[model samples]
Target: MTVFGCRSCDATLTVPVSRVALPVHADQKYGNRPGSLAPALEPGTFAVNPLPSGPPWRRWAELEPGEAEALGWYAPRIRISAGPVGQVLLAPGDVRGAVIDPALVSDSACCGIDGGEPNMVCATCGTPVAIRIDDCGLRQAVWLAPLTTHVIGDDLGPHPVLDWADLIDHRPGIPPSEPGGGWHPMWAAAAGAALAHLLATSGGEPIVIPDHQVADVFRPTLDRLAGPGRTGPERTLVLAGPGLPDADGDLALIPQHPQTGELWPVAPPVRPVPLAWDAWRHLAFHRAPKPVGRSVPIPPEAPLALLPGPRFEPDGQIFLSVLARLPEVGQPWLRAIYDRGRPYSYTFHVF
Candidate 1:
């Protein structure tokens, strides 16, 4: 348990928190609705993205030569974040003594904040401490400003108890949709990050997921991107984890523990594609009995009842951003995907 306190006033600001890996989709922007996405990190958890993020933007042209390489971007972006590294990201609910100031919000965003500027101020001293972003199309998060806060307690006791087998007994079953049954942004974010990994090691051969529910989300885009294979079935990826039979396929979709961020162990020769815990859990139990409902039919010309979210386009930024960072990205075949690939943007839907 680490307690974060304001550097200026030394006031306690955050609940006891444990460190976890920065999620591959940490910065992902999902459906264009405020509060639509889950908190970037779970409560009682935090992550430090050593990579530079946040404001003080620099256009690609304006940057000095080699600046892009310095910032960990292998491919070009329209604009890049030139802010300081070591920013602390955790759920806003974990914050204890800070209140959001509407006036301090970054104006680049319309509905809520974009998080480049400080929106959270210390209640005791009014020192700018963090920024809260809960906007349409962006993640709902609170980023503790660099150097504004520090950890005062370090007694995080008995953490990382989520062993591979323990998760099944401890965590509740994960349903595919959010609380009222709509496409989950976490799913979109997970798909984006996992697709990058799937493509990176794919040798450009078409990807095949045996899980029918997961296949609906990834297989179509993968088929188009990697191609339908020149020869017969090359390999297949199937959901795999503790208490489940080993997949006979070439690849396994495995869980990265939510608390520790370590991928579940798999036997060698079976490559692993890491999905966040929730995503892995959902796919692992996709066959669990679910309530079935009858649908109300509407004319083809009539509009669907809802238009709350953007159509199912996987988060391209997450796809490319993650692809660019993979150690295997140097491979020529994998380089083409993030460097100059259209497969991520092709119109597709899995919902």
Candidate 2:
């Protein structure tokens, strides 16, 4: 767990927290319909959003020459944040030794705070140091004011990035289905992020993903997104991971390292698309070895299992959020899709 300190007093500002990659969809609305939005990072963890975010956004034309590209904006943006850089994000509940500044909170926003400025202050120095956001219809997170905090230390000594072989043995899996019977939120996100890569690498050609569950998750949208016929041969995407055979398809679906966020490297010509670790593990290794085509009859006393819902929609927000970051978005073909906001318009239900 890493610790952060208030820049003003050199006093500790946060509890020791594990660091994680900010979710690609962190800025995009998820769980915004028919339910409340949860905090971006879970308790005891934090991440840095490398991109500028929140308030005082700058229009593309307003950007000074060379400013946009330096900030990693390769393509034209309708509007981009000119706010604090490298904002630290964590659960609102995770904040410690701080108080919400009622004066800075937005009264017009419903449910809870939608802080654009510093709403959280250091308990010791009374300096405005963080922002707490919990607007009802939007995602909730506490973002530390950029210049107000500094790294103190990491409580977890020498955290090691696991080897792929070790990860297979130790890492836990995320359920594809949740207790209440819809696609698990993590599954929707994993599929959505991976789907963006599939489209980018598809070369605007038809893609064929053949693993039963893999195809089941991605095939519907792939068919829908492919435009009318060209006699071109199809492209295949197949699972590739540690302890699994080398992927023979045109594209290999691999797992990103849970701790390090590194992709399992593959050699030339076979393009790699990464899926979040737990999600990939669940898909690849969740099934135990069993006899094929040997059906077992259900016992008379057995309880029925809840089957998955017929429609499995990947969150479109997750798709577009990730697609916007990829270098492929600069291509004219993919650029058109990004500019048009395909995900928002597509009928496949976005979470």
Q: Model 1, stretches more than 4 Å misplaced?
A: 34-36, 62-67, 157-160, 229-233, 288-313, 330-336, 339-351
Q: How far is 60's C-alpha from truth in model 1 (Å)?
A: 3.0
- Whole-model Cα lDDT per candidate? 0.73, 0.74
State every prediction's TM-score relative to the real structure. 0.80, 0.83
lDDT of 1 by residue, 71-99 (tens): 88665566778888888988888899999
Per-candidate clashes come to 2, 0
Q: Indicate the residue-level lDDT of 3 in model 2.
A: 82
lDDT by residue (tens digit), candidate 2, 1-351: 688888899788888888776765455455645444666566788888777876787887889997877767666656667776878987777778888877778776666677667888899998888888777656677888887887888767234457889989887767778777766676777888998898888777777776766777787766665555734678889999888898889998999886667888877789998888878888787653444585895444442222277678777767876787677878887777666664333343323
